[model samples]
Target: MPKPIEEIQKEVVEEFSDLTDWEEKFQYLIELGEALPSYPEDKKVEEYLVPGCQSRVWLYPKEDSGNLQFLADSDTALTKGLIAILIRVFSDHKPQEIAEASLSFIDEIGLSKFLSISRRNGLNSMVNLLKNYAKNPNV
Candidate 1:
């Protein structure tokens, strides 16, 4: 089984604790973004586009053994990293756990301070989508 989301988040926090600077955190986010797989152009449809976002977004959730796994793609580079962060924080969690995650946690991570207004809005949209996916009974 995969580690719990809280453990993953703690690991991320510990990994960056040595940096001790927001700029370094931002650089790390960018690096994470660089590692995200590119979204296929064919997948960029209205159904996948997240509302209130400046860039296109696609999120697909797969449930495995009562845990939710997310596969996401975003048009903007930073948003891809935002998705990566969300995946780190929520993926492998039970649906209830993912649904219960506090959106304010992003602010605590200093993500909002580093992201532009548009990117922040995009992040919000992404969070909503993820939460909704987690809450979906059909899954």
Candidate 2:
């Protein structure tokens, strides 16, 4: 089974705690970005677009046996990793679970502290998109 979000947050905090500087944090973000799967070019347009992001983003959601699954792609590497992290936390959950998760969990995971203001805003936008989808999957 996949780890719980709390466990994942703890792991990420512990794993990266040694990085004491912003430069190191930025490097780590890039490294995380490297692990994200590529988004197909065709899917990067229209309805999938995430506004307020510096990079192009596309998110597709599907329901499987009462669970929600998200497939996301971003033009910017760091943004892609950010989406990957979100997917790891939200995917495979029931729509109610996804919708009910506190957006403050981003800060609990230390993502807000390490990210730029714009990046944090972008991340919020992404989370909002997912929550909206969870609330209205047929839209």
Candidate 3:
């Protein structure tokens, strides 16, 4: 079995702790975003686009064995990195696991401070969208 979500979150936090400055953190985040799996061109549609983001972000969630698998992308590089962390924390986890989990890593890593007000709103939108997908009964 895969490591528990908490373990994954802890690892992420530890990884971020190594980067002492926000500039290095930002660069690290971009690298993380680059590591994300490719988003399908066909699935990039209006319905999947996350609302309230300054940049265009598309998120697709599929249920597999009661866990949510996500495919996400953004028009902006920084947003891409932000969403990648969200996906890393949420993906391959059960709906209950995702919905109930706390995303304190955002604060722990000082990610929120790095974001502009609009970007933070967009991050919330992305998170809400993911939670909404988890709450779907039909998935």
Candidate 4:
């Protein structure tokens, strides 16, 4: 079984807490983005494109036995890392859990304050996309 969403968020917070330097945090995000598996080219269509982002981001949702899984990619490393973080917390979980998640970890890790208004809006859009998928898988 997968860990609960709260537990996963706590883990993310713990991971971010170890990096005191902002530069270190940025590098870490880049590393996280690099760690994601290469997204399939075919899924990079308009239907999967996330809006409100400065860069291109594509998110593909798949359901397996009632659990939702997300495959995402971004043209920029930082945004890719942002989506990776969301995937880590939300993927492989039940739709209800994902739809109801608070994503307080973004605040706990100081990421929100670091983001520009546009990037923040993009992040919100990505979260909304995932939540929409959870609430209505046909989306």
Candidate 5:
């Protein structure tokens, strides 16, 4: 069974807390990005592309018995790491759970302070898109 979303978020917070500096945090993100499962090449089409992001990003959702799993990739390492975190928190869960997720971990980790305006917007867009998918999984 999957863990509760809040538990996952807290775990993420604890993980980020160990890094003392922004440089270390960034390197950790890069490492997380590098660890993401390889996204399928066939799914890298226009339909899966996430908008509002300067970097090209793709998210593919696979549903199994009402739980939604996301497979994602990005042209940039930071973006990939961001999506990887989202995937960890939101995937393998019911659509309603994902839709209603508070996602407080983003703020808890001070992730926004490190992002540029455009990147922040992109991050918001990504979150919105994930919730939107949860709201309409058939789409």
Candidate 6:
């Protein structure tokens, strides 16, 4: 079996814990965003677009055997980084795990504290959409 969701989330928290300041964390986030796999231009259409974000975010999931592998990208660097973290947490897991996993890691990493209200809303939208994709694989 793949690593447990809690382990994946905890690892993310540990990674964030090593950054002493928000500036460092932000830079780290940008690096994570930059590391995301390239998204196909054709996949950038509305069907894959993540709504309610400060920038455009596109998400697509490919199922291999039983695991859900995600493909995502964002128009803004920060949002891209944010999705990278979410992808790291949720990707390559069963649909039920993706839908049910507690996302307390967001707060644990103090990410919410730095987001603007609109950005927070956007993040929530992203989370909901991710779960929806998991639950409705046909999406």
Report lDDT (Cα) of residue 128, candidate 3: 91
Report the alpha-carbon TM-score of model 2 versus the true structure. 0.82
Model 4 misplaced stretches (Cα beyond 4 Å): none
What lDDT is reached at residue 107 by model 1?
58
The per-model lDDT (C-alpha) reads 0.76, 0.78, 0.88, 0.92, 0.92, 0.91
The model with the greater lDDT, 2 or 5, is 5
TM-score on alpha carbons, each prediction: 0.82, 0.82, 0.95, 0.97, 0.97, 0.96
Which digits, one per residue and each the tens of the lDDT, describe model 5 over residues 1-139?
9999999999999999999998898888888989999999999999999989999999999899889999999999998989889999999999999999998999999989988888888899889989999999994
Q: On residues 1-139, what C-alpha lDDT tens digit does candidate 1 reach at each position? A: 7786667777776666667787777778778877866656676677666688887778777788889977778766667777888887888889898887665556556677877888888888888888888999355
Clashing pairs in 6: none
In model 4, which range of ten residues has the least summed lDDT? 130-139
List ranges where model 1 is wrong by over 4 Å. 37-42, 103-105, 137-139
Instruction: State the lDDT at 32 in candidate 4.
Output: 92
Once fitted onto the true fold, the runs of candidate 3 whose alpha carbons sit more than 4 angstroms away are: none
Worst-scoring 10-residue span by lDDT in model 6: 130-139
True-vs-predicted CA distance for residue 115, candidate 3, Å? 1.2
Model 4: per-residue Cα lDDT over 43-119, one tens digit each: 99999999888889999999898899899999999999999999999999999999999989999998889988988
Residue-wise C-alpha lDDT for candidate 3, range 1-139, written one tens digit per residue: 5567788889999999998898998898888889899999998999899999999999988878777899999988889999999898889988888888888888888868878899899999998988888888255
Worst 10 residues of 1 by lDDT: 101-110
- TM-score of candidate 1 on Cα atoms, chains taken together: 0.82
Error of 1 at 48 (Å): 2.2
Clashes of 3: 0
Q: What does candidate 6 score on TM?
A: 0.96
